[model samples]
Target: MSIVSSEKNRCIVLVGMPGSGKTTVGRDLAKRLGLRFVDTDHEIEARTGVKIPIIFEIEGEDGFRKRETQTLDDLTRESNMVLATGGGAVIRPENRALLRERAVVVFLSVPPPILWERTRHDRSRPLLQVSDPRGRLEELLKVRGPYYREVAHIIVEGGRGTPHAMVKLIEKELQALCEH
Candidate 1:
């Protein structure tokens, strides 16, 4: 059966490190499932009329996280959508609790090396702007891994396949989950 056929009010949430293909996979999954797509980072930028880096420069990571939590609260209430969250969204216990309760969460697990390769040239990620970005990615992964696992109903390896393939795997897992 189609992933969305089971419930009208359900949402598919994509959580992972930056460059783990959450946004790309989410867009594909949403289109294939005929659902709306929302990226929390983009939503924040849209709402605040500023880029994330600018937000970081002004309100700082703490502030950005506050916006993220608020956005997650609002977006998780919507149905028929695929939501791609920021890498650090799982950093807070409250965010983890809400994600676990509000949607069928998928954690895209990609190794730090691959994530570094994918994100090395991207200047948009506020966290990766440090002098040793690879080290930061690894550290972030180590700290956040448990949180992602805690919040996710499914964990899918992300770096080995195309976004479409990942979506197919996610769809298979979602179908299996629905059956149980």
Candidate 2:
């Protein structure tokens, strides 16, 4: 299914867990919608010329979160784009407010087990570099899920559908929003 481009020209921001397919789905959705796509984490890496894990190692999570918030603030200012935000973007109230005010926030919901399965063995994720990555994933989900829901305008079940199908579901939801 295709989404008709409305004149609204809003940014679409995808927020979810680390392995919830935000970058992949956001890229496809942006392509389908004929908009630019920016993954905040990628943008951060590009701007710093260092990978996220390195940033985490050097600056720590608080420092990394500062960068994420700054990147999101910058990206949200652009129009007619799809942005895939870092998993922990919602941790900051300012980031959440900016996202809600400036974009159509989509929460790509995946189960903790699925997230663990998808993210395991990935060394790039600094937060998951633990003796108990599965438990860490579960802990993060429990802590962050409410923040995601609070900021989300649409909640898409990522585990149940293909990326294209998920995009279609998001489009349908956007259409419903427009109707209202």
Candidate 3:
């Protein structure tokens, strides 16, 4: 429950569903903590020189996932960084292991309804292109919930708060660990 522990690495990884505000909160959290901030999805886009939706269109989810895993592997190795991971990063066992072993993994949990509200009009989410995006989100949550829990060292409620407020809550949690 504490951020301080036997783990020596200073990396903090944020994991969760697509609309959980990982990138926003992670950036603020990193700034508050004075660590580098990196969003895996953005890293992927930067490397490929295309938006994620474009990558999904060209390479399919499988190819994008391969790239995600590679990026996650590389980012987790760095010290003093806050990394916002892709939503489905926990689907792969290797990614889960790397996240758990190399850094403090925090799951930003938001209810499905809230997630839908946040992402409904976002065309960039490749997975939500279905006839019923809410249905897809619910389905993904059902399958991925356990993996998220399995890899998370902490679970933070990610709803009804500004990114700065969420960062404050996370900072409190991390500070509690440090105090111990």
Residue 41, candidate 1: C-alpha displacement in angstroms: 0.3
How well is each residue in 27-119 modelled by candidate 3, as lDDT tens digits?
998888778899999999999899999999899999999999999988887888899998999999999999989988889999999999999
User: Estimated TM-score per prediction?
Assistant: 0.96, 0.94, 0.93
Candidate 1, after superposition: displacement of residue 96 in Å? 0.6
For 11-64, candidate 2 gives per-residue lDDT tens digits of 899999999999989999998888899999999999999999999999999999
Each prediction's RMSD to truth? 1.5, 2.3, 2.2
- For all candidates in order, the CA lDDT equals 0.92, 0.89, 0.88
| Model 2 RMSD, rounded to 1 decimal | 2.3
Give model 1's TM-score versus the native structure: 0.96
Give the residue spans of candidate 2 off by over 4 A: 1-9
Shift in Å, residue 29, candidate 3: 0.6
Q: Best by lDDT, which number?
A: 1
Over 4 Å off, model 1? 1-9
Ranking by TM-score: 1, 2, 3
lDDT of 1: 0.92
